[model samples]
Target: MTHTIAVAPQATKHPGPLGRRPAPQSVAELLLRAEALEGFTVAQLAAALKLELPLHNRRAKGFVGGLVEQALGADPKARTQPDFPALGVELKTIPIRPDGTPLESTFCCAIAMGRADRASWEASVLRRRLDHVLFVAHLAVKDTPLAARRFARPVLWRPTPPQWQLLQQDWEDLMGKIGAGQSGHLAANVGEILQVRPKAAHRQVRTWGHGPDGPQAVHPLAFYLRARFTRSILRQQG
Candidate 1:
């Protein structure tokens, strides 16, 4: 039997019973709001906010992220910066399997391809994104409908000394490639925990990147945290 949660109109996009939550003033207020949603299933969330879930995976992937932004009062436009600029915090929704392990890699932020060569670890985009993150772990097993998935406890993660070391090391290594104009040769297997992959829906999309021959067309690379790293964070929190 397929156990699914009862949801409101699946086609609706307007604010529903819960309407929309106000922007949290402080980190305390934000966590209070997040705590209220700790155990709620996706259906309950969508039903309350009257959000529509896309039928397709590509569209659904972004819709779920938007749903979190709406619920958390973060502006999607400022994704280049942190989700909540006021609090200097970023909100991330991690899909976890039964054992509380991440089902996939977590998207960190976009790469500054042009200036990556000289970008310092202290001012790197990855560093800023990881500075303070609100990680909302959701139950995301295969075959489970998006609406039926439940959200687990949210973890507020700040890197410790060792965690910082790991990220800095990866950043420096990846930066070396970009600096040397060898970004064209970067593979998914380059970094230990932080890796870069093209951020496009198809092969046709391309972006200008520094190449050995000067400037060349290449896939737009973005930062991603390996599942193992995120799993470690959750385990440590527990």
Candidate 2:
């Protein structure tokens, strides 16, 4: 049976239970706070925090991520840098299917296809965003309501040498393609650890990219960490 989770009356005023200031001082403190949310459903957390749960799954894609940020006392500002700029850590919520595999790739960030040609791995935004990450994995069983999913223990991760190399290779390859004006030919299978895929909500959504004649309209794309790569991380953490 379907259920309509109730919204808190003060949700609008008190967006998160934890107020804005005094963010977590360290990674230990952050994980400790995240651990407190391990057993609660999204609805339960929202209700406790006097927040409103999303009415639909598609519209709520970022709901869980927001909840994590709130629970950890993260800064409210949506910056291009890490969620905890002070700690140099990015927060990522990963959706995992019943079989323990990620439901989909983890989106890194929207990239400017036209500017990618001039980007370098050492100076890439994607590299900086992923330099340190706090991953919160939640169960995404088929047919389950958004409010009912359960979270696993969150892990703070930094890639090992091999993992870093794989990611670097992928980044260089994809950037090379963009530089060559071949972004139109890129696909999901282009990289082992990372992939550049379309990010727009609709097919007609377009972004600027290099063309034979100059800048041209092209599909907006974002960098994503492949599920296999994340699965390997989970195994290592275990």
Candidate 3:
């Protein structure tokens, strides 16, 4: 079945609730600020930030993360790098069940199907993006209204040595095929923890990529961390 990706633009930024508290100087400062809002509901934070909460959330897919970013005073110019590049931290807002299990996969990064990337695992965009992440979770029960969803505990995390191995292996496997014009054959189950999925903003969106028959139109792809893996990261929260 085809997925209709939402293209509705997010509302423009308004003055932050804290009047743009000076950008976080250190990781400690960032976490402290994030933790302070651990129990705030979406309504409370949105009101504070002057955001007009939407009546229907279908067009607000990344709304929560944007709210948290503004709350923490993230710089808008650094969209291509980690959300908080000053502290080498990527801000990720994950939705979780009331019991702490993730509700869906966490978006990792986009893949340029036709472009060559760094061969070194340590130098890859995905590696740097996942290097240091500040995860702020929110309760996402199906029946819960968006405004009433509470921000849960925040966790600062970096993958362990063992975890990195698995991730790197999957990265190699996927990139190998993607680089070799075999993208058409990659199944959804190709990776153990990381998976590549189409990331278009609409059903008909397409991009250039290699296939067995050489360059061809391909579905744009983005990497995602399976919910099972994210649940483990939250479990290991420090």
Best-fitting candidate, scored by lDDT: 3
TM-score of each: 0.88, 0.87, 0.88
Off by more than 4 A, model 2: 1-22
Model 3 bad stretches (over 4 Å): 1-16, 116-119
What would the per-residue lDDT of candidate 3 be over residues 1-238, giving only the tens digit for each residue?
Answer: 3221111132233223663556799999999988777767777788887778888866444888888888897877776588888888988898887667887888988888886332556677789889898888887778888987777878899989998999999998898888788777778788999998878888588898777777888888888999889887887672
Residue 38 Cα positional deviation in candidate 2, in Å, after optimal superposition: 1.1
Error of 3 at 234 (Å): 0.5
Off by over 4 Å in 1: 1-16
RMSD of each: 5.2, 6.4, 7.2
lDDT of each: 0.77, 0.77, 0.79
Clashes (N, CA, C under 3 Å) per candidate? 0, 0, 0
Model 2, 46-116: lDDT tens digits are 76666788888985568888777777777777467788888888888878764557788899988878887
